[model samples]
Target: MSNRVLKILVPIISIILGLFVGAIVMWMSGYDAINGYIALWHGIFGSSYSIGETIRQISPYILAGLAVAFAFRTGLFNIGVEGQLIVGWFAAAYVGMAFELPAFIHLPLALLAAAAAGALWGLIPGILKATLRVHEVIVTIMMNYIALHTVNALITTVSDGSYKIDRIQKTASLRSEFLSNLTDFSTLHYGILIALLMVVVMWFILEKTRTGYELKAVGFNDHASQYAGMNVNKNIVLSMVISGAFAGLGGAMEALGTFGNISKMGGFTGIGFDGIAVALLGANTPLGVIFGATLFGSLKYGANNMPNAAGVPVEIVSIVIALIIFFVASGYIIRVLLNRMNKKKEAK
Candidate 1:
């Protein structure tokens, strides 16, 4: 088979294998695996409310996934997306609360603040990596801690000992007028639209822009790119800045649309970490990230209902997601199995 064919087949086979393995594990643990899966499906797609919830949950995943995917295209591992996201969250929230402008100006301004904050956060690691020869992975990890503590401290100061910030102004908040009937007045907002728009924008940027070509070239081979007259260091830094902006936007969506305010001691949420898996599963592409985020969001939303109905732990969702990533990452095993089966058929 051609390499392209193998690439296509491997992930499908790996998913099947992962599901089978997950079923076996669930069965051995004394759970009715079939019922568990049914419950999960029901929770994710059974009703309009469930579907809306799934979309809401995955909205941030899309942006976070895009952030990681963008960085991957530049051959950079962005572990600090969590930190960048936090900073963006706070920056957007603070701006939303501090301002009193019309929605047209207020909303866009808040989002822009988020992007800028995230971009600045990402620039730190990019500069460190480009000029100081520091590894991006290490720098990003450290930046996560700094962002968390810094946000936490800022939140406490703003809240005057309270944990949560005051409700965001109406103009800056994201509301869902279209899905009010489906959500039963749930907090699910219009941020999903923003995320979807970003998916398209990212696709255009990566597929149609010259800067994207430079970024891709650097990712393919930095030494070769430099030899070919590309500004490798600048591209590296620019990639991080763009990636950080995406992550920041993700955070802003969550803050303005979902939470409505920032919280002190705002912990490092796993959304950013989960983005790594999402990007990998999607092969670091815009459309792939959307599909991957949807799958993950469905799993997360469904898992929340499982603990109540199936007497199973919601944490199992994480395990399943991890298994999926593991299988995909080692997809050569699936290719080998397929090759063996084809050879057996020929022999027969």
Candidate 2:
């Protein structure tokens, strides 16, 4: 089979296996697997409200997936997207609350602030990895803690000891009354449009730009790229910065679109971590990430209905997602099986 076909087949096969195994688990636990899945489907698509909220959930996942995928394509492991996202959230929220500019200026400025904050957060690890040869994973992991505590402190300072920040100005908001009404007053917003735009942006950058070529070349082999006159260290820094900017935009989607404010968190949001799975399932491609994010968003959002509708535990859905990720991670085995099957067909 062709590489393109294999790329498509692998994720589909993994998802099927995940569902199959999930059904088995449900059956063993004395629950009707089919009914659970029916409930799941209904939860995701039953009402316009469900569809709107699912799309809303998917908006951030798309950007987060792109953040991880961009870094993966550039040979960087950016565990700091969570941290970058936090800082971006804080920056956007602060700008939205503190400034009183016109909609055009205020909104753009808030978005820019978010991207810049994330880029800055990513820059530290990028610089360390490029110049000092420190591992990006290590630096980014530390950065997450720093970003969390620092942002929490900053939020308290800005809010006068309150854990919550003020809502953004309406002009700077991404909320859409038209979309909300269209979707039965769901918290749907224009962030999905922004997310789609970023998808195109990521694709254009990686597939049609000189900087992308350099980044990919550096990712493939820094020594070879250096020999070919590419600036390896510079590309590394640039890749991380771009990846971080995507993650920051994800945070802005939440602050400006979904919640309209920022609040203290007891723990990580897990969006960045989930982005890792999304990237893996997507094969590190821009368009593929959309489908991956959609699948994840559907499963996650729909899981809420399993208990009420079918008496199935929500944890079962988590297990299914985990199994799907596991199977995706084992793609080499799937490839080997496919190759063997192809050989058998050829022989026949």
Candidate 3:
């Protein structure tokens, strides 16, 4: 198969394999696979409210996926999108509460604070990787723990007893009454626009810009990039910074659109972790990430309803998502098949 065709076919096949595996598992577990899927569908598509909720959930996933994919394209494994997101969430919330500016200024300021915090968090590891060749995976994993604990402590100390911060001022919010009313008061907001805009921006940067070319070249072969006069270290840092900024915007969406307060994170937000799978399944494309996020979002929204409506364990939904990731990761198997086809054609 051609590369373009393979790119499209791989994700589709992965999705099919995931659904098939999920059905087999359900049948083995004595669950009604048909009913389970029916329930899942109903949960995701039955009501306009449910549809809106899925979109709201997907908004952050898209941004988070962009963060992981952007880093991947630059040959960087940013396992710390979680950490950057945590810091950005806290920073956005803090700015929202600390300031009393007009709506136009306050909202932008709060969101910018989130981006700045994420970029700074990413910059630490970038600098380390550039200067001392420290391993990013280890550093980012450690940073996740640091961000979690620090945010919890800060919130606890600042709250004077509560584990959550005060509700953000209206001026800093991304809430949209029109969107909410359209979906029977779902948490849908203008942040969805921001997410879609980022998709376009990421595509433009990766596909139509010189800087993106340099980053991709570095990712393909750092030594080659160096030989071609690309600044390897600089590109690495730039990639991480941009990736973190994407994650930061995700945090801003959660803080300003969905939830209006910062709370103690007893654990990591799964959004960043899920983003890794999203990025892989998306094949590191901006448009692909949006589609991947939408799929995951449907599963997430439908998971809760599966148990009550179909008597299937919610774990089944998780299994389906995991299977999708597994298939995506094993995409080299598809390439082998394509290679065989090419060889046969050449022989003929």
Candidate 4:
């Protein structure tokens, strides 16, 4: 198979294989795979409410996926999306609840605050990597803990020793009566538009701009780019900042659109980490991320219904997702098979 066709084929086959493996696991575990999947499907898409919830879940995944993909494109591993996201969430929430202005002003300001906070968090690792030859993986991972603890402290302080911050002001909310009514009063919000728009923007910048060329070149070979007059270190720093901004935007969506408050967490909010799988499954492209996010969101939303309706464990759904990720990450196997087929056809 050609590379183009192989790209499409691998993911489709991986998804099928993942589901097949999930079913096998379910059978071994004494669960009804068919019933589980049926319930899962209904839970994710059977009703207007479910559809809206799926959409809402997907909005953040899109941005988070973009974050990872952008970093990967620039030859960087951004393991600290969680940290940047947390800071962004707090920053957006801070702006949202602290300000009282028209929606047009407050909403954008809050979102920008999130992006800025995320960018700053990301920049720290970038500067370290660029200047001191420090590995971003370590810095970013450490930063994640720092961000979590710092945000928790700040939120608690703001809430006067409470675990959660207050609800955002009305003017800063992304929720809309029209959207709620359209989706049968689901928690979906206008943040979906922003997410979709970001996808478009990512595509445009990465595929149609000189800056993208520079970034990609640096990713391909930083030394070569540097030799060719590109600012390799600058590109590295810029890529991380951009990636962090994407993650922060996702946090802002969750804060303003979905939750409407910042709550204490005992552990990392797994959304940013999930973006790694999303980027891998998406082939690190904007359009591909949309498809990957849909699958992920469906599985996530559907998993909640499995135990209740199918008499199956919710962990089964996670197993299926993990299987899918495993297969996608093992795509070299698929390509080898495709190459063998191509050789056979040539021999014929």
Best by lDDT: 2
In model 3, the worst 10-residue window by lDDT is 334-343
Write model 4 residue lDDT over 6-39, tens digit each, in one string.
8888899999999999999999999999999999
Give per-residue CA lDDT, model 1, range 77-165, as digits (tens): 99988899999999999999988999999999999999999999999999998898799999999999999999888888888888878
Position 334, candidate 4: lDDT: 82
Which lDDT tens digits does candidate 3 get at residues 1-348? 678888988889899999999999999999999999999999898888898888999988998999999999889999999988888899999899878999989999998999998998899888899889998898888988988899899888778878899989999999999999999888988988999999998989989999999999999999999999999999989988999999998899889889998999879989989999889989989999999999998899888789999999999999999999999888999768767988899999
Query: Which regions in candidate 4 have their CA more than 4 angstroms from the true location?
Result: none
Over 4 Å off, model 2:
none
Positional deviation of residue 173's Cα in model 1 after best superposition, in angstroms = 1.4
Worst 10 residues of 2 by lDDT: 265-274
Better of 1 and 2 by lDDT: 2
Kindly list the per-residue Cα lDDT of model 2 for residues 174-247, writing each as its tens digit: 99999999999999999999999999999999999999989999999999999999999999999999999999
Overall local distance difference test of candidate 4: 0.92
lDDT against true structure, model 2: 0.93
Clashing pairs in 1: none
Deviation (Å) of 174 in candidate 4: 0.6
Order by lDDT, highest first:
2, 4, 3, 1
lDDT (CA) per prediction: 0.88, 0.93, 0.91, 0.92
After superposing candidate 3 on the true structure, give the runs of residues whose Cα lies further than 4 Å from its correct spot.
338-348
